[model samples]
Target: MSETEQNGEVTAQLVDGSTPATPEALFEKLDALDIPHRTVEHPPLYTVEESRSLRGELPGGHTKNLFLRNKKGGMWLVTCLEDRAIDLKDLGERLGGYRLSFGRPERLMQYLGVIPGAVTPFSVLNDHQDAVQMVLDSALLNHDPLNFHPLDNARTTAISPKNLLKFLEAVGHYPQVISLD
Candidate 1:
């Protein structure tokens, strides 16, 4: 592992001068994992409110993914339902007092290979080093088909909660589930 990896730089090179996985490449990986997913291409959505416009056309539970880091430079990707309320301070307390803050856009791209609007658990596909910790809300499991951007905000992909976990494990990002109750 590189020093960057030790410091939680997930977007580092993939072995030897290789590039991060593209959205299409990520889809292929999911396919290889035998993870069933349905995707819809539409206008780019940068916020939950923007995604609301497609509620009628896009069915299933949508998600909001956060790329965060702690004072110690530990990285975390938290995914929960789009409408779920989040109290960062409280969450930080629950997660071992991380002093959490949103990761910088450059680091996000470098690690997850995605911009602010495109952050998703799928971005882990780019983190070949497993440098980022994954945090998932248990409530999201109640939804049969969970929706997320496939490393791009221009499209949304739906997959079963079980399959999501399976895919994450396959990619070496086993989630740490939390209940928001």
Candidate 2:
């Protein structure tokens, strides 16, 4: 938090002081792995439209994360470009998650440890039980720096696609990369 380093990741607590999934903890993990990242704080964003409005032209692959559960209670965290259209039925067939449905808020917190608007692969940090599978869109990997909420919607973090995979593997949640057509 210096003059020249404005807009950098500060490793701070979430507004609610939530445990096991705070931005502070995520930042610490990123730092420990020597994964270089840049983060900027802005007005809390709950939608793609709001992100574009407030985050104006941030260079990178802007992402939207989905928390889905299959009929068998299996869960997945899907990260794709904000503009990517997802057909849940097709996705379920492809991922072998037939009859997929959005996880309830309570289940979302139970698994990924984040609220609806705050869902992101980074929340897998709190997936201590490794109960959720991570699915990454192949198109997202083409972008040099991919952007995601750092366990909260008020801030966004940027990292290289390679580093993202590295961080995920380090955390024991290696993602299944697929093209979501």
Candidate 3:
């Protein structure tokens, strides 16, 4: 790991450029962007129910991310409140695409640089091609602090709602926030 201070904030870079940012590196980027955040380490969580068991009293808008693709091959990363009910059929129409289905694990890895259990908005950083469209539920933005996996399922990070948008924009993803009700 290499650390550098730029514009008054410290950032960490991976020694190997070929690998995606580790949880620590992701925290460094958040710090460099001046995006306030808190991270908690835990055993890997693959589902919302599993995460809820470990999150305990952490207060924030916990999220469940879906890696999806349209029939035409367009991809999307949809992040929403963990309890929100998402109808893939309706979402496909709203997104103006053919029926959407869960993206394959290989495609998810190719686009987001994370495996099935680690889907996250933070993974946008690894999308050097900017090929994945980001869809955020408006309700998640309504929370003061939004929580997500930091490109890894073994931990969760919370950032202010506004700062979440800032981080996404910085990573070349302009999120589309809509009502997921």
What is the RMSD of candidate 1? 5.4
Q: Tens digit of lDDT per residue, candidate 3, span 95-169?
A: 984699999886776667787778999998887778899999998878878888998898888889999999999
Best by TM-score: 1
> Each candidate's root-mean-square deviation in Å?
5.4, 7.8, 7.0
Off by over 4 Å in 2: 1-18
Q: State TM-scores per candidate.
A: 0.88, 0.88, 0.88
Q: Write the per-residue lDDT of candidate 2 for residues 40-114, one digit (tens) a residue.
A: 999899988898889977898999999999879888999999999999999999997487899887777766667
lDDT of each: 0.85, 0.85, 0.85
lDDT of 3 at 79: 95
Quality of model 1 by C-alpha lDDT: 0.85
lDDT for model 2: 0.85
Residue 90's lDDT in candidate 3: 95
Writing each residue's lDDT as its tens digit, candidate 1 over 1-181 gives: 2224535655444433356677899889889998999888888989999999865566667899989888787889999988888888888999897688889887787678788899999988888777899999999999989999998899999999999999889889999999966
